[model samples]
Target: MKKYLPLIIAILLLALAYLTGYSKYIGLAWYGKATLIGGAGGIILTLGAYWFDKNRLNITLIALFAITTAVTYYYARIFIDSADFEPTAGFVWYIGYHIGVALFIPTVAYILQKILPQSASIE
Candidate 1:
């Protein structure tokens, strides 16, 4: 149990931060929701990669995350443009959301690697 304590904690924190609504306070309430949804979709792709022994497919899926993020930004732009609120404010909010998503992903991956160094399965 001691051996996996850190991994467990990290996963718990990830779930709480991403799955729960706590992240809304970070000025990204929508992103918190998007993260939960996007993470779910990512899980499906990742699990498929594992189940089929598809390394290339797994890497491709990871790359697709970045693409999805870019698309998210464009969607945000459209959403903001359509909103009646101050256009600048909406644009800034949308940009911030995408940036948060972009930053959180690599940071989470790095944290996971450090916490589970012996888990070669991450590769």
Candidate 2:
């Protein structure tokens, strides 16, 4: 229940971004902003979980939530202003984007885990 809130929010955000035709303005700044917001939210949610004695923090999921939120926000902004918005493209775009992220996150995280300081690992 409480443990699932972050994922739920992430999914909802992605759904709105894609379904509402808002991906046209997505860009780096948008990604950065989303990342910061998602990360902060994850931290807060983790704290809540600890206080509530529900599920403990899951670093990988937290990272996925943060990264997905950031990416979704960027996609929304990038496509939001497209004059030729095709309603169908949103679904296709979401599937393709998520597939890419699914493949990319673990690999990138693996590399980062090796290169970055141990403190930086999501765990």
Candidate 3:
């Protein structure tokens, strides 16, 4: 159970991120969109690669970031037109910014996991 906790938390956070995006209440729909598609892509890629490769996690994370950035930009046109919000940057720049943020999750998680001390047992 302890070994799987981090995975479970990551999954839950992904879900929560999507829900928040779908809700569109916090004005961060781009994040929600990115997480939704990226996470789905990640899951699919992870499962598909699991049998052939030992680096499924890394592959999934990379795919998630790439897909999320692409999808978010693809969908952003519709969102921007439908909503009244204005973007400060061009579409390419906006997408790049979001991608940077989206990719931060895995990078930060990796760093934290490496820097933090592990517990001998989880209660």
lDDT of each: 0.52, 0.45, 0.49
Q: Show pairs that collide, candidate 1.
A: none
lDDT of 3 by residue, 1-123 (tens): 443333345456556755656425533355555545645543444345444453344665677667876777676766666544454235545565455444544543333334445551121
Candidate 1 local Cα displacement, residue 19, angstroms? 7.1
lDDT, model 1, position 13: 60
- Model 2 lDDT per residue over 2-115, tens place: 334443444445445545645334321234344334434444554454455433334544665686677767666666766657864565464444433342323333333445
- Which ranking of candidates, highest TM-score first? 1, 3, 2
Residue 5 C-alpha lDDT in model 1: 36
Number of clashes in model 2?
16
Task: Please report, as a residue range, the 10-residue window in candidate 1 with the lowest summed lDDT.
Answer: 1-10
Lowest-sum lDDT 10-residue window in model 3: 114-123
RMSD of each: 6.2, 12.7, 7.9
Q: After TM-score superposition, what is the CA distance of residue 39 in candidate 1 from its true location, in Å? A: 3.0
**Window of ten residues with lowest summed lDDT in model 2:** 23-32
Clashes of each: 0, 16, 0
TM-scores for all predictions: 0.42, 0.30, 0.37
